[model samples]
Target: MNSLKRIMVGLDLSEMDDTLIRYTAFLCSISEIESVYFIHAEKSLDIPQEVLESMPTGMPADEKLRTSLIEKVEHYFGPDSRTQVEVLVVEGSPLKELLNLSKVNHIDLVVVGRKFHMRGSGLLAQKILRNGRVSVLFVPENEEPKLDHIVVSVDFSDYSLMALERMLTSALTKPNVRITCLHAYQVPSGYITLGMNYEDFDKRMQGFAHNKFAQVLERFPSLDGRATLHLVKQENEDDMGELLVVEAKRLKADLLVIGAKGLSAAALFVLGSVTEKMLRYNDDIPMIVYRKENEEIGFLDALLGND
Candidate 1:
């Protein structure tokens, strides 16, 4: 999770590809990435007879697409870039192709477009987020190429710690980058059963949360300037995820990172509830959903069988 050697950028034939290309190049310039693959999946490489007859280029659909993507990479990624780039044009279901290619190529990260104020339905991003085992970076259409501030949602769980470890060991661990572990807690109604008043229990809850954060921070000296922000869930605050998105925006965070609790899509990959909730409410900020990729994905076989 720390050393991201290779990555795959999912490209759709849209304006969003321009943004993804630039952002991915910016990432390679900063990180120690060795290889990058720009992949686009088409339902079919066959063009209708009428369509082929009216086309500007006589090349096959797949070859033309590959040339266009390569040109885009050369334009934004630059010819002198250190990273080795490849263009893959696959024919099949987009989701199936992307998932299979990533596994076959041993990709460390999957970069996909998170359409906001764009033409896409954002369905591909969600499907990739839910089904892929590798880490995913969801870049919105208008997202800038930056990684200054990273906000990680924490509940003092191992899943949250896994995410924080990634940031600490990631290439963005430079002095300029800032990482904040945000935690949201609620004062239980049972606190009153312990013979403490509402105000007394509230202060106690805050104290407990601070102690936990201190312990967690003590384990990582690299996070010296790192701090925690605690939010008390109000009676009517139905979604904690909304609060996290709000605070991250308030801090002008460039990326949101979280660890999904389990490997199953039903368990919420790259989400751990934070991303699961914000997927509905968030529109602008990019998010990095970290999850453990199982060695073998039976679910993928099911998806492929659906074809």
Candidate 2:
């Protein structure tokens, strides 16, 4: 009901079947959401025209399923709620349909339910992260959402800046928000590392990282210097993924934001060791991953299927 005009939630029959609906309604009430959409996508093989004709609305049974989904969603949120509830059943690709709905409906935030392993499904999540325009909040099955401290994994890249901007925009209404801006840089070592003094390298890198963070802070002057700045230099090893989780847990951050492409499985393998390995398996902390515009997403090709 605040300024988050549209929130699109992806609902499916899974372990956390109702998690997205509950979370969406809760956020809608707090954000002053105008309308709430519960979209369910069904993957099907081929169907004869006769079957389609016999179905309600001359559509697939999936389309008829909208009625039940609507009832279930409303039951959770209750009929007394002010937010208008709309249920849609689209017969096609899941992510593609969701993205189109978001664009057409002017969705502000996209809520997705994330399940462990499931092979191909993880790829679907990756595709949504890569292709969708809305900010994606990946909620694990059965895990409650939290908003205590936000951990930002910053690489001082333009992509990271985009994620930071999202964080600032989403966090303003929060009365007390603790932000940890983390940067991990390599400190040259070994014989080549010995050629350059590690101390001086550490000093310059720390100053540079700190300065970049300061620039980001300036961008959001309203933050009023409440954020905690962190600069981490890797002398012995460089494991971005492991370090981020370790530090986040150490700081007890409730939310985490990181650029999507930066943490791609391929990028992690080539760029260096990354935190993605941990993220892929761990769902303890809810993560908001931002995929920038113009990024190619072959991984998400399945999500755009037949749409």
- Candidate that would win on lDDT: 1
Model 2 per-residue lDDT at 194: 54
Question: Per-prediction RMSD in angstroms?
Answer: 2.9, 5.3
Candidate 1 TM-score, true structure as reference:
0.89
Instruction: Mark the regions of model 1 whose C-alpha exceeds 4 Å error after superposition.
Output: 48-56, 226-236, 263-274, 295-307
lDDT of 2 by residue, 44-144 (tens): 62555564553457544765566557666876788788888788878777877787788788777777777774323645555555556566777766666
Q: Rate the local accuracy (lDDT) of all candidates.
A: 0.78, 0.67
Clashing residue pairs found in predicted model 1: none
Can you tell me which runs of candidate 2 are displaced by over 4 Å?
A: 1-3, 45-60, 80-82, 117-122, 171-173, 189-196, 235-237, 261-278, 293-307
Q: Residue 157: error of model 1 in Å?
A: 0.8
**In candidate 1, what are the lDDT values of residues 61-143, reduced to their tens digit?**
87777887888889987768899999998999888788888889998889998886778787887777666777888888877
